[model samples]
Target: MRGHDRFNTSLPDDLIIEIFRRLDSKSKRDACSLVCHRWLRLHRLTRSSLKIGASGSPDRFLQILSTRFPNVTDIYVDERFAISPPPCIQGRKRSRDNSKVSSEESCGSVGNVDSPYLSDAGLAVIGNGFPKLEKLNLIWCSNVTSDGLASLARKCTYLKSLDLQGCYVRDQGLAAVGQCCKQLEDLNLRFCEGLTDTGLIELAVGVGKSLKSLGVAACAKITDSSMEAVGSHCGSLENLSLDSEFIHNQGILAVAGGCPHLKVIKLQCINVNDDALKAVGANCLSLMSLALYGFQRFTDKGFFAIGKGSKNLKNLTLSDCYFLSDKGLEAIATGCKELTHLEINGCHNIGTPGLQSVGKSCRHLTELALLYCQRIGDPGLLQIGQGCKYLRTLHLVDCSSIGDEGMCGIASGCKNLKKLHIRRCYEIGNKGIIAVGKHCKLLTDLNIRYCDRVGDEALIAIAEGCSLHYLNVSGCHQIGDAGVIAIARGCPQLCYLDVSVLQNLGDMVMTELAEHCPLLKEIVLSHCRQITDVGLTHLVKSCTMLESCHMVYCSGITSAGVATMVSSCPNIKKVLIEKWKVSQRTKRRAGSVISYFCVEL
Candidate 1:
């Protein structure tokens, strides 16, 4: 059907690259690289980022990376595990073994192994190799120390963003980074217990003037001293996230008062009161986003102060703030008219008036999430639907008082709504979900997990109305083949379906779903005992693109059925089965037969 000139040799270099770019998976890309020399070269050159995992020898991998992909700018080194010893230790194994411990003894050492994958030696190689590196994320690289970081900074002077979350980098490492990496703009040091105020102060003094974003979350030792240094030097800082108990009101005030151009701030589990809020409001008038969590000290007074002072505020999130009431919410509604996204979780004090005020005032609000707010009933949702007509994403979780009335209001008003998640709302039934489907035809993602009252009527409505790609109706015992048949007929483009724990689902629904939903990739049938081998055979034969099938506690599925499924769908990667169903040898064979098979039983 084709000639030699119409092949790869005739295609232009740019066209080859454009075609290669469209390949979806890594296997396809790797296969394309094997075609010719030009393709391999183009593939190598087009790549810009690299991720090195803690699997094989890091030294050898680094050597390969340096040789094959030399122009990589972004590198993410995940050192979450320990494999064999580093090349330095391996080379001198015999000599080291005579005086020091053996491999078994080394592996048995207490706590986490330092430099399990890439150690100081590996860092030296990296520093020498990637000269043009800009962004380096060594997240959970617990072994990297001061020497390695200093070497990286000295060699890679172009580095701008560095994340060392969960690393053991201490004050010395901070000092090294501060002294060498002066141009660094974004730095995250979350959960690094080795860091103290002295280290933080040195870092602030070194790059504070140039730094734009800084995250020092879970660094409990950091105090007002470090905050003072950051406030004084980091005047250009626009975003800061601090989750520390040691840094009290003094630290908050210092940072707020000093960073005049500050726009975004997130504080968690801190004992900050109205004084800190007032300082933030007064100084950071340009602030647009603020998030506070787990504090009762800053009540209505603090919120009112923020509302009155920071009139340009747009995004606000409050969680577990028991002290906040309708008064505080009203204050926010009156002041922050430019608000677009609002999320309130675990704050039960606010009533219907609070949501109504927010909905009426923040007319441009597009995203809203109200979770674990028992006081918010149908009245609150109705008000939100009536006022915030442009709302696109809505999440109402554990709001037991909300029922069909709230759903009707949202369906009637918010025509542009796309993503809706209502979980554990016992009051909501088929009426609410059906109303949602009847009104919101543009819906793509819908999650009604643990809403036992929703059944065939709701699914039928959803199938007819929305072109849903992801649908989750887990724990709805009333759902049966009729509802699933409706889904198969309506949502032909469905890719992900979760019908777990439904008692009435049988092989008929599975057969129809497999035959109709050609795009179906993942399906969860856990606890659905009615599904047998007939369903599995039909699913494997029809859904050729299926990747993962979770059938935990599915007693009807035996070893023969699983074997048949593997034979039918060679592309099926993950087949999760309950532990006690098959033998150990069978489990091992299943894994060998399929790419990814889990037998936890």
Candidate 2:
């Protein structure tokens, strides 16, 4: 028997189906399907999920999906309006086209009508097709109105998770979901401005016992009363997110008093003070993750109360909490020993002393983010590195005072670091990056954006030592073609690279990247003036797997260069080549036409 035949015979059909079911990534499953016909059939039969509505025509996608995967249980229809209609829409007219055209004209004559590609009729078709769908995501489906949502909700009664983010969902649509999807456990209504207290009350009463997670961020109309309804009815609620200027202490107290099982809460730009946080600390006994943002009225007193109450807290994010000082951080450090993930942003008053307290107290801290915290310097990082020896991820964006000494200190202690971002820390030079590259062997993602002093020495060191999958050296003018070549040669697994604004880099870097980094999926070369048609053509031809190429303000590139790249990589979605003012059209052939892509002047 041949190798394929032997392999197929080795594993039984049941075993093959079980093995294929365990594979998570779509790409991996696809590769496995290509092994043989038996595996292909098994893969298709076992697959139960599909995501469309981004590129292909929604109508055609629905027909194909219904025919191919009749047993699909989950569908995510994200019909983005950023680009024009896809290739499947052209030269194909629906039987109802004449009626749609006439109705559109009438609507246009009267007023504005946001006639989205995926209309109410399309949603009805989907509802009829996927009756067994348990999860449905209709994010950014702007044209989908209350009628369409109601139609979908009425049909998909088995839906446990429903995401209508950025949709035109209002009281009526929410009411429909509440009435139909009684088994719904997760609901996200982010950016649904048309929703209000009436809708919330209706939803709370309908899905009160089953609802576990709720997201209402950016829904400006939702008020304190709305939250009160949620707290009163959603007794089983475990996760809640609220944002905007309305939610206050009353709402916080209501939610806390009602939902004792709440484990996660994210409050952003709300008018809640120390009283609200204190309530959460006292009542939310199971709270483990808490995120606070734009709490101008909150002070150290609130954090102190929170720390004392929620001793089991594992994740905390504080952003724009300007009033919080060292005392608050000290309180938290002293109280919450279980804290493993912490992110502090725009807290100007927090310095090395506060960080030291956290480092010393929360020894298990594995993830930390300190953005725009200017008071932190070398000593602070040293303290953190020494105390949090198990640290795995660190992000220090625009912490201008940190230099080589701080980076070296971090490198010595955080040996297990996997991701490090030091954006706009201009004081640090090649030495700091070199230290990290040498010590942090597990680093897969590194961003040194706007660190102009970084040169080939640091890049070469990282390339030699680490196998990074994502690297962004944007605005590091000191790096050139030689540095990129070293990176391509050493780190052959690079998937995303952003070397924008490197004036010295030419097509040579592209050639090297194309030849070595076969896994490169996205490349950003904005303002790379030296890169020309010669280099770009080689890149497109060699790196056929590339999905997106951004080359803004590259004066050397021309219309011909873009044409060559697109013609070769026809599946490429985003090819942003602005500032060069290049636009070219290829002659259309039978049964095929060039897809409309984004091209701005």
RMSD (Cα, Å) for all candidates, in order, is 4.9, 5.5
lDDT of 1: 0.82
* Runs off by more than 4 Å, candidate 1: 1-32, 81-116, 582-601
Clashing pairs in 2: none
- Maximum-TM-score candidate: 1
Per-residue alpha-carbon lDDT of model 1 for 1-601, expressed as tens digits? Answer: 5545666657788888788778887779889898778789878765678887785456545655666677788988877744443444344333344654344243232222333466766677678878888898887876678778888888888888989898887898788788888888999989998899999899899998789998987887888899999999999999999887887888888899889999999988457788898898888899899998887787898888888888888899999989899999999988888888899999989878899898789888899999999998898888888988889999989998889999899988898899998899989999988988999988999889999898999999999899999989899878888988999989989999999998888999888988789899888988999899888888888888888888878878776777767667757777777545555555666664333335545
Q: Which ten residues in a row have the lowest lDDT in candidate 1?
A: 106-115
lDDT of the candidates, in the order given: 0.82, 0.83
Q: Tell me the deviation in Å of residue 148 in model 2.
A: 4.5
TM-score of each: 0.89, 0.83
The per-prediction tally of clashing pairs is 3, 0
TM-score of 2: 0.83
Predicted candidate 1, C-alpha RMSD = 4.9
Residue-wise C-alpha lDDT for candidate 2, range 71-188, written one tens digit per residue:
6888887876433433333233434544343333222221122233456666776787778889988878776788888898999899899888888877998899899999999999
Clashing pairs in 1: 578-601, 579-601, 580-601
